[model samples]
Target: MSRDCTDYRDIFLNDRPMMDARAPIEFAHGAFPGVVNLPLMNDREREQVGTCYKQHGQQAAIALGERLVSAEVREQRIQGWVEFARAHPDGYLYCFRGGLRSQIVQQWIKEEGGIDYPRVGGGYKAMRTFLLETIDHAVAECDMVLLGGMTGTGKTELLVQLSNGLDLEGHANHRGSSFGKRATGQPTNIDFENRLAVDVLKKRVGGIQQFVLEDESRVVGSCALPLPLYRGMQVAPMVWLEDSLEQRVERILQDYVINLHAEFVAVHGEQGFALYAERLIASLNNIQRRLGGERHQRMFLQMEEALVEQARSGSVEQFRDWISVLLREYYDPMYAFQREKKGGRIEFAGERGAVLEYLRERVNQRV
Candidate 1:
């Protein structure tokens, strides 16, 4: 039945659904996109089996696992696998190493359901290695351009416009700033790397050898950039994006205040506005050390006032005051310092239109 598939590239490139048979803890620690964990053994069972193996060796441990699972428990798990296999006929199942655990599941599925379901030949570890190699290879071989700008300059917006753009913030589910967190939390670091690697692989597969990426530090909110891409970004030619302070402030108002408030509302419903207000306050507090005591207190008071006005009148106009001050007095200077440091790598500098045109030309030039 050709039940072991080893085509890692095809599986990822096609966004194939996958069933992960590792313990729940393992799946939570690291997993690819579109993967569901239907573990062969739950955490407790796996732990017991492991302890038994250490004490009594493999055969005894296997016997203990079988007894722990019993017939009824085994049938329940097999039924879940049967349902998943039927639901995703094209999907493959895997364990940490495609070892005894995955083999046992395959044999059970066939014996109980008379169905031949495939498993990933080398499983999760092998697939992770492949993704890491993908990122490393792209870093070494691809031509990449970085979009640099002050806060609120809409660097992310520009990146999305390019067909070859790699939106790291988008992949990380963050805004890449002190205020970048979304209503939902960021993915695990392993999940973040897996997603980033998959994105680069699919883009490269689509003939995008040249990529446009936002200039960012190693860490974006909670997700860190893969080391290879971070190193590449340090020396990559940069297109600096510029905007008037008034315009930048307005953009930040939209992204951090207006849009973010709505996002919180959508996610949390009745509790949304309160959570939104809390998030804003927390975001402000995050930079307190840098903002200094007096300035931070002032900014904090202004933010509290703005949130009151927003909650009362449903108007976000008040946010512009704090947003503008932070950008001018805080984010602007920091970004400016970074710009000066990376001055030699700056190939072009202009407002959005000019920068977009310049970046597009860079991609076309490669073509």
Candidate 2:
């Protein structure tokens, strides 16, 4: 008796391992979570077959593919599948669609004395459909509360501190900035979204009333937010955080020291002192422009000097003060304008810890 392909969906939702028989490039675009790539054809070979199909027709392409994959090569591929299946007996497999490639692989596995592995019903296309549908459903049902604030109000820190809520940036292993990629490298979009969906689903199952997320543009690094989620965030109630310039700057400096110290040293070398000073000045240059002309240049140079002194002395306080001053004079006013435009919907404002405690209390009261 033949096993049903539809059962693969259950396997996927359960976080069981799976394999993609499509080319690597195809898998990279999007794939189910936990799906390993064991392509029947590599990128170049896939490209050649595609070209043949377009130019010489399907028959020619099929013939060429057969010639390319000899019996011994096919056996070796089957052996690899056998090993993986032995390791994960309940594993799932997929291809571009429930097409010839997957059927061939599936038959080979069964013939090789490997346990029957379920194939995705409609293959990767079906999985993609499911993911998009799930995202849409989540967007519709949840109340999204965006955590909006100036650069260093400890928004990310507060999210981490919260026992409830999704941390999209943390899951991405990014700070959601130009300088946010991990030293290891970023995950593929499929992988990132898979992790995000799993986290969100878990929270929803645990009866989370609302998701607390940082205010981010549609795209974070290379990954794009689902359109529905982004749209919902735009209209949702926003909790803006405010802090004293002294506190905010101290927080920013501490974050850099804790998170990016090694990265800074790696990029700038042992005498990273001068390099960090320059970077700080460059960061303040944007604010300097708002300050205008000679005043901008003066503040710019002063901030640079302060940073240099701090770096030399191994004291971040002075540099933090310098940035706090810039933020007070520059970024805060912009934030004020935005807040006024947002009007009464700005539900709360205070230090991160205080705001989180207040929100948690309010939520508990409602419960």
Candidate 3:
């Protein structure tokens, strides 16, 4: 049993423990930080109960729920709550809303295990609403500097190294390219927004003078940036990282070829290399219309040649040649167009080391 009142501010500000007593399906879709799902009912049970609630009224629904969840089943759920509460004395439980579900769990834990576990103030929906609003509030208040570069200029690398960096792509779980798909799917839009909001709020609390971000188009994988943040990025000044074609090609080979291949193997094991070849071709095919017929066909052959050599020699150096061609004929032209579109917005440009050094100075001076 909880005290009379719980503050939402303390939950967000103090990094408290959270237990989500929603169904597995609900947790799988999305939930907030430190939220462990210990459902009061499983998915099918919840669905059935929900249907009963709609068809009959509250009393009828409650009667059906009691019939369905046997005493043994109820005891097991209480035991789960007891175990969790024993481990985390300060943790709170939440359901879809801060309502009957949490209260029921609270009662069960109290009677069965003699332990007290509080339910969150407003539960998932209310907490979710708070996070969603917090995003725009933080973005509006904070200053921003966007980094602009074509693929493989080490922009993502520099962003991680910098003090105030906000890696949006990392949060979204995508690389933001035609071939940028992760083996795992992107989080639901709700999850993406939650992660972004929490991160922005953290930086705001830390008193970041300028939030450093990589320039991203609206979509990363299937997750689209919220319109407000995207609009802010459009107006924000950008710093471009200038690296030589050879250097850029090397970086591409490491990321797209070597690192991607390793990740594939880690995920899929023996079948990974074959699947990697297929994905690379499919990725190139995805951009085929933009690449044009002849160029696309040529690059496809180049990729095949590179992969064959790589498999034979256990070296991905061969990917560099094809990558170099793509950089010149494909990526450079595309990036140039975007740069031209935002001509006045590019405030600084330098090679990787110089650009990083400059950013370090900027971060220090802000203090």
Candidate 4:
């Protein structure tokens, strides 16, 4: 008789470890916490099996997979399962749909290694559904505080100070701005949402009374915020961070240019540094219509000069020339106009210290 399957809920609520049996390519696109990729068939082997299924049939594909993965190769695969099972005896192993690949692995492990781990009941699809639902639940359960400010007002920094902060940008690994893409690319959309859901779960467990989120658009980098949370941010209590233009310029300089170049250069070489500079220009150009044609052209030229100066020297001091202008002519006016749309939701506005104190006091009031 077949064993009963382990479901997604069991894995999630227990925070169970999982061994993903999909190829590295599939795992790279999306994966959750408490999971590690240990493929049954690697990328090339998976491709060959896929071709077999397409040209021949399911049984032939199974035959091809078995033949290709036999001998010492088969022992190597089984050893990974044994080691993981020894580490996480309660963990479940899963593939894309709890199908043939999962079954073959399970049977192989039991026969060769004497471990009989079950697969996830509905596999990746079901677990993904659970995470999406988990996000919806978090939105409904918590009161929220949304941060607002002109660009470079240190809103994300304040999020770190708050006990209940949920930095969606941190989760997405983007700055939630045109210039925010990292040298490391953003997560796949599925993984992004999964990470967000995990963050929500963490805050919930910590007794968060009013979780804080940054002012953001419908999307961050390559991932869109889940609908319920995005909508919740729109109507939540709003607090603005107030800082002078000089401070904003300094902050943006630190973030956008001064502190950013080395990592990209180290990773992708001269080509990488050039690409990073190019992205800076592109981000400025992206707001052209709003910046107006003349101001936009001037801003582009300014950034070009700054980059050239940085290339000559070892510092990015000139980048601030463009930074100061972008803040004054572009970001501040845009934020002022946008703030009008939030209506009466603005509850407080203050400097960085005051805002942090206020958020701490609010957390105390909750207690």
Highest TM-score: give the candidate number: 1
* Candidate 2 TM-score versus the reference: 0.81
Task: Give per-residue CA lDDT, model 3, range 328-355, as digits (tens).
Answer: 9988998999989987998789988888
154 Cα displacement, candidate 1 (Å)? 0.5
What's the true lDDT of residue 247 in model 2?
Answer: 73
- For all predictions, the C-alpha RMSD in Å is 1.1, 4.0, 1.9, 3.0
lDDT for each residue of candidate 4 in 104-219, tens digit (9 for 90 to 100): 87887788778777778777777788789878887887788888999999899989888889888888889888788777788888889998887776667667757888989999
lDDT of each: 0.91, 0.72, 0.84, 0.83
Question: Which stretches of model 4 miss by more than 4 angstroms?
Answer: 1-16, 43-61, 68-72, 87-90, 269-272
Clash pairs, candidate 1, are: none
Query: Which of candidates 1 and 4 is the stronger one according to TM-score?
Result: 1
Report residue 89 deviation for candidate 4 (angstroms). Answer: 3.9
Candidate 3 is scored at a TM of 0.94
Candidates 3 and 4, the one with greater lDDT: 3
Kindly give the number of clashing pairs for every candidate: 0, 0, 0, 0
Best by lDDT: 1
